[model samples]
Target: MSGGDGQPRDGSGADQPQPGRSEAEESRRGAAYGFTAYAVWGLFPLYFAALKPAGAWEILSHRILWTLLLCLVVLGLRRDLVWLRDLARRPRLAGGVTAAALLIGVNWVVYVAAVLNDHTTEAALGYFLNPIVTVALGVLVLRERLRPLQWVAVAIGALAGVYLSVAAGSVPVIALTLAFSFGGYGLVKKKVGVSLTAMQSLSAETLVLGPIAVVMLAVLTVRGDTTFTTDGAWHMTLLVLAGVATATPLLLFAAAARRVPLVTIGLLQFITPVLQLLCGVLLLHEHMSTARWTGFAIVWLALVVLTVDTLRHRTGLARARAAELADITP
Candidate 1:
């Protein structure tokens, strides 16, 4: 959900404060946004599952195209048309965003396919693995330090991955792909700093990818290989609604990213995979073998450790801040 500081990962600098808001209030708002975003993301199995008759490619294209249209409208409303101009001035930044777009786009296609292909359990596992992946990225790539319990959580996560692969008699490719792609996406976005807000960044990513989405949709239509050509109005409506599905959670995520610490966002991400596991097991009727359950239990235990550590840290920090304020009082 966010880097530890909830600030831009780009290493550029601090955000200029909005005059009216207190930092405490902003963090509260951020936590709310982060929770909402993850909750919506957790329910995405229903969204992708409903896109029957359209393959993942078709669904992804519709999502991109519609999301692009929606972003354009929103940007227009905000009068934020300067993305292109700003990118033009910074070719390296454009390249970075393009790379990020591809990672996320690939992640999207794979996830949609997983949902429709009855690999929702794998998909859910993938997201559960993602925060651990993100934390690992922080340590390895950014040279960040981890608390002892945080390191223990990461180590346990590694064991979970190994157990799932060994017990399942196959590598958990879907879960690994999802975790790595999204983890890498977060890493790159942070590295790029806050040159662009989340909306602007997504707008630019879709813009870069939009032409290809158009061509792909057009080709599929011409070849009679697309849902739009064969499906009824309801299907088409759902397809177009992919834009709404895509945009809303992302917008909320952007809002949250600005307001919360990355670790806080990370902890809240549990909402998503937990919901997804429910959808996969209870709703989709996927079998949950004892071994699979064991694997999940290990991961869940790791999350419990991580969550407890994070909560304690925050509580201690809050008490310290309160004492500081008290000392300053008349």
Candidate 2:
């Protein structure tokens, strides 16, 4: 066995050397991938922000149409068209995919409303709380065991959400919409299985929505209320960019999600909300009351606990991976 410095190491004691470094490198690479994912997700506010005074439906239509077009182009580039073709052959799977597509469409429209209505901060909070919600849902729905600390973190986040809702004088519809929709989306994607490439799956999902999106765009154009004119060039450009922006990060996220552990991904999910919160306050100059700040602090604390637990979980997984690798070596 060799150390990072290349000195001969004691037999079976090699783990102290390469294993730590290997895991660290893996984590670093994984973080880079994960960061790329969050960064893309984080920057989404700016993308949606640019879609403009166009109502949520119009924005959604452009998103669906361009996203489908981009996904098709991407599938062709990757030569994964066969997977898509095969998907069309299975009626049940196609139906499920179609249902998932509608769910995502609803999620997208809700997100746009949040952005347009100056609820980006609430949207951030929603995603911020989503990881914990996902963890709790996993326990309830999938019969997964949660570490005690994880349970506490999830509880803390849930309480913070409730507090925030009351503080806001009503249910924070935008936050709830973002949270449940995304949480539900994640669950559905899991049911969809990893048999398909991320691109293929997203393409199929969007393809189901494509027809409706096309009809909406056409109707808007016919009524002269559409943002499809050459005078709307910048908006149109942003519209198409939405598809590229949407697909690229999702593809990056899929790459990272496969290479990293769920805990790692869960922990990394915090980045997007953090960025969005900053963008909301800094760029958009949105007001956050003291109660809102307090709620955010509570959520942040929960995330910290969740992150620590994930790190511990990842350490155990890393050790198991090293042991498995040693067993397989001649």
Candidate 3:
């Protein structure tokens, strides 16, 4: 039943252990999870595009409000209100979630504005630069030492971003705002020790935004400026998809984060923005001037360097792990 490699030998001479089979199944699940996350992120431009007619501010308010409602429904269905109760018990954790909530709200608003104002490419650039920002944050906040090559990569990436900002006339305020807000969200998320589910975290974050959303919606309605009435059913559908569009990738990301190695997650994060860039160029037919293209090329090269450095680090860590295990055996 078993082979030298602990794989079970089938009647057709194929080796497959039950444990290996289980592992293979889990790997499949993890790939599906990761794929779903990246795919949703990749196609987000289409969803956001449909909501462009509604105006960014109104769409942003709806996103915040509807996401909150949807999350509440999810919590009710799962009967997981305990996370909210837990947060209530610890006001500090609630405060952190509230801060995170504000950060992501700003992120959503900026992203919507970028998409609406023909700056989809800029939004893509912001995301392309996010990994580097995260790495820079790790260096500053966590005091993790980066390899020499990584530092160089960060410098190059930053310089490319600055070049693009300068070339675009004004500083790329939208890009920097998007990156810093989302980066801060990531940092805050790292601090919370509470065992909140992904839905719970989203719920808490949106709950923090709910009152503001209500006020915004009421103000818009009273001013005879609600976009929903004139935006038609098709547009409304797109607005609602904001909830699904926002939540699905996050859910898949949560599952993938639990299953995959951190190195793999780090590698996969590039796919989203890469797809956004392609969508902006091909589908949206956005133009990048020669200098802007040059800046993009520089950023791409920096990312390649950073990625190689990361792989080297991961390999080194893996080797160190193997050596530690071997030492324990003898």
Candidate 4:
């Protein structure tokens, strides 16, 4: 995500030419895209639920295979295969992309398993905890220093984990696995400084995993357990549409990131988890005991602290930039 200094001045020395209007329009458009992307992500439980009779492994394999095919077609049409040559020359980046592929594959399988097994609420909780996990990973892996509020937020998050574990009589393994896997994936992508477009990145990652997915499908076929052929046209279509479903939000998110501020994207990220939680409680009718609710509440509190810190930090940066500009002006 990119951001401006919140100041749109021109050489004319007057904030005219309707720059503010154009910026406002751009921001509005980006926000719309971001909202749609997150909304789609939030409603994924319903989509996965509809793909029944196909186990998690089957769904994951088809998702990978079809997504890779779709991405290849799109890239070919756009003549965007130059990145492949560039990636071939960078061994470290190639390794990072491979690691990213594996991590995301783990994430996809675990998520499918959670949704299929009616653990949608747990899946939602995992996403809700994702930001906290990312922050922890930055501190641990990147040796980044945290702000005071961030430390407080992390401490609160830890307390919530303890409470949840004690209340449930065990660790929330599904949630933690989802959070850590995704966090690690993000870290790897960041370290690699991925320059690929959304489609290109998806293509690269899926290409790495395509062989495994093919092998999985072949084994399923040998065992007469494949649903792609046995399932009717409707089921087949849904499975095939998985590629479109997977890529659309990602493309939208990339568009939004280019047009909007990082802070706006950060705020929008919460929409997905919030919607997922609602879907689990309302649509899926997943049980949310008092203990679970309490744990979620604590996590939300931590998020509130973290968000406040972020906003304040952004505001401070904006003010500092304005002050510097004023000092340099005639």
lDDT of each: 0.80, 0.72, 0.72, 0.82
Candidate 4: segments with Cα more than 4 A from true spot? 1-21
Compared with the true structure, what per-residue lDDT tens digits does model 3 show for residues 157-213?
889878887787778777677777777777776776545767777778878988988
Span of 10 residues, lowest total lDDT, candidate 1: 3-12
Candidate 4, residue 289: CA error in Å? 0.7
Model 2, residue 66: distance off in Å is 1.1
**How many clashes does each candidate structure show, in the order listed?**
4, 0, 1, 0
Residue-level error in angstroms, candidate 4, position 324: 0.7
Root-mean-square deviation per candidate: 4.4, 8.9, 8.7, 6.1
- Top-lDDT structure, candidate number: 4
Error of 1 at 238 (Å): 0.7
Residue-wise lDDT of candidate 2 within 102-150, one digit each (tens)?
7678777877777778888988888777778778778888788999999
lDDT of 1 at 105: 83
What tens-digit string does per-residue lDDT give for candidate 4 at 45-83? Answer: 888889998988898898888889998998888787898
10 residues in a row with least lDDT, candidate 3: 1-10
Write out the backbone clash pairs for model 1.
2-262, 3-262, 9-190, 10-193
Q: What residue pairs are clashing in model 2?
A: none
Give the distance in Å from residue 309's predicted Cα in candidate 4 to where it truly belongs. 0.5
Model 4 weakest lDDT span, ten residues long: 1-10
